[model samples]
Target: MTRSPATPLPPPKARRRLRETAALTQTQLATRVGVTPGIVRAWESGRTTPRGRKREAYARLLKTLAEEEAARQAKQKQQEQQEQQEQQEHQKPDEKQESAPAPVPKLEPESKPEPQSDAKPAPEPEPEPRPESAPVALTPAQAFDALYAFSAPALVRQTFLLTGRREQARESVERAFQAAWERWPEVARDRDPVGWVRATAYEYALSPWQRFRPRHRHPEPPPADPGDRTLLNTLLRLPPRHRRTLVLYDGVGLDLPETAAETEASTPATANRLLHAREAVAGRLPALADPQVLHRRLTELASNERLRAAEPPAVRRGGERRARLRTRAAIAFTVALIGTTALTARTAPTHYEPPVSPGQAVRGVPHRVAPGALSDEELELRQKLRDQMQDGPERLLPRLE
Candidate 1:
């Protein structure tokens, strides 16, 4: 018997979208497919692919989800069309009456103009000159400055919401813009330059390392309003991931997919975080159960605080300075490395020298003896001299001899 081919799955993003639309967590899908949640995550993230039976099960599940989503969207579209038709029907009579042509004025006979030779025609006003129609192209620096000006203030406010510290918020926005300026080509070509900067700012603002900084160790003063303070406290209490998801989705008015993409998380995971974040906030302040209310509260909280961003020229100059410092440091390091290498090559030994072998004792060798103890004759002679030393003159004459 021949084996049938395995079923194919959709792309990673689509797979994730399908799972999220079906409201299935990675674990839940993993359980049905007899695999680990990590495996399911990997599949959705495009790190791995399923095969054989698991592939078939996953494919079937996704196919069902896709069909359901399609049907739901179609139904939604049909409902929208019906609403439009109803609106048109209701507007038809008014539109017809408005479209009716105006009544022609009565044709009265005109009287001849009474000629007054002295009456001068009113002086015709000269037309104002029109300005140039073409748009002015911006230099790279000017373009970056414009982007920074347009996005920096609001981004600072948003970063403040992300991180409760005003100083860090401003710093984060400045650093993000600096980075954008450094990569202006890539940023300019991006479909959403604002989004690129916003993502960078959010990442920096929400960085885990920020918590370790001594300056950020202490929380900034809370908003004066009790409601605003409560809302902000609740937001800060949330995990960073959930807080960011909540901010992007509810506070910044991003859709689920956009938030997911920005946060670099799967759609289902993003939804889960958003749900948990909402629950946490709602649990604290029941009044914020509505997303619109939460968004308004977020806006009010951000606006209540005074956060200002650096000037665009200052930011651009700072970026350039940083880039120059890095380049110089790299060059210095390379020069030092090359110098060390050259020195080593120049001073290194040109040839190998044989090592001296250690000496060993011979088996038959004897230790050398000291000079024989004072000779017997020398001792006798010394005794004789001591005995015969009668006269000093004789001793002196013998010494002369």
Candidate 2:
């Protein structure tokens, strides 16, 4: 049988006590009690209290904390007054001592008139000061929306640069947003929430997704080539180290020193990796001769990957098969055309086969020799090319064949 979800237990007195003892605000107290502040007000008003044995605990806890806070405030106020009074007394004594001699004692005193009045007794002394806590504030909805917009994209970019993984960047942004929701006041106080999120996202990117996963993979920065659709593809193929180096150097457009700091590598190592990375790219790179083109390509790769994540392993394998088929088809077509052309060139007949002289006549056609064919050089030229024919299927093979 399916178990019905248990009815949530009403807030007990003990929870209220915890809130009271913590001296938390309604919202803060509600958070600790796991109930809304409205519920707290209901309990305090005696309209409803937690039921069962837990009720006793809540009542005792809240009552004790309330009493304690009352006593604490009373004590503190009393102390302040006492200190002020004492200071006055001391000052008065000093002034009197400096101006005149000792106090004069009265020789005789007579009662004048009795005044009727009711005077209250002095209040008790206050307790010691409670440690001060930082103030907590709630964020406005508009503030939260602005924060999310600023932080999300910045985090997304940082995560990409740090882990060379877009998915991780997305997850990092989500986690940061959740964190911001819980402690929005703190986020609001930051000078640059976007920068904070970006930094946090990069830290998140460095963490392993799962304990069992490899730790060796480090993310690279994006490339600079704007027109290059295959920029991301090149990154996907690079070793993790090279990827990280390239990403810091190119994706973020960091200088060598900054790249080294970002990657936690020495400047020399960073410089070396960058050098090799450029060389590697240049070796296979075409369309990358211009710096503008390279920048466009890199930008395109980062933007595209940010939009399209990698396929699942199974789907990727299927795609690989299709790619292989296309490659093979292209190779076979190229080879067939080359071999057929060679055979045709060897078998074709030429007009100069009988070594026709300039202004000579053939059986049915007038022959015009090429310019340098006459002289003793004719024999040399004949040997050099006795037969060469115009291009056509007819020259390729005899009609009988």
Candidate 3:
């Protein structure tokens, strides 16, 4: 498989937010992330993304953000609870003191009640409150480890494929983490933060760049041996909605219904796009080869490690930043390819058959065939013809019998 040229993952704005929140200058964050202050500004402003090992550094920074946010929330909650408990305790003593002297008067035993057949029994007493445990905060290191472990390279790869640019995917992923970190206290409670991040990243990946930024060009078909390059190219030529349907249905192993949900498209629309995409692929494939076979082969190739080998860097450098950049670039490349392929398939001609044949008689009009289904004119013509023939044909035949 021919590796496409890699692009650098661009920097994101989270750094600026972090700095502002921390009341620190760009120099401060740069010092922490081990980059020049200028680099910090560039990243914050979307000028460029950090490369290779720098991603780990960035991840670490995000972890710090999560930890700090978590700590702040935990402290606030603890303070609130403590204050409420203290207020209650202070009020309890006063109430008890006032009531202490008002003991119940001694009284004679009451007469026993007669047995009742229909009375319902009362419910049992409520359980006592269990001792509450101390709030445990996730350390920055622990949070970083979790994020690192849960971070799937595949998502980045997919994003890269969609955008045909590396930095964009990295920024998207970083933004996802930044969002999560900003609300870490709430997000951490979720059973699947990784899943949430993945979903968010994909959403970001799907979104187009703002009008100011360069619009993405459709991805070119990858070389064959990786599959039918022409078919892939055709698939890439489709509209985004249709292309997504095709990818989710074929590339991502999603059924029609699932693909519909994933793409947020109606079932009929999804089905139509998928059908068209398949037809386009079929049209482009070798006559002897089945479209299904080609689709499966392409899917396999996409998933293959050999095909997925990280492309060589346009400018090689030794370090963590470079590595992160490479990973992001690879991811972006993959996503662009998948999204483009799906889009392409949707727009291409599908060889759809006509629903109606020319000269077919229609009800209510003359027998002239319409471009679409029988036009009103044809319908009327047909009705007139039917009425004319209603009387026995012998009525119009010559009397010479």
| Model 2 alpha-carbon drift over 4 Å, by segment | 1-144, 154-166, 176-193, 206-229, 289-292, 305-401
lDDT of 3 at 315: 15
Error of 1 at 53 (Å): 33
In the range 311-354, model 1's lDDT, one tens digit per residue, is 99999999999999999999999999999999999999999999
Q: Could you tell me how far off, in angstroms, the CA of residue 61 lies in candidate 2 after the best superposition?
A: 49
Ranking by TM-score: 1, 3, 2
Q: lDDT score, residue 225, model 1?
A: 87
Against the hidden true structure, what lDDT does model 2 obtain? 0.57
Candidate lDDT values, in order: 0.86, 0.57, 0.59
Which order, best to worst by lDDT? 1, 3, 2
Error of 3 at 42 (Å): 34
Error of 2 at 259 (Å): 3.5
**Poorest lDDT segment (10 consecutive residues) of candidate 1:** 392-401
Clashes of each: 0, 25, 54
- RMSD (Å) per prediction: 19.0, 32.2, 32.4
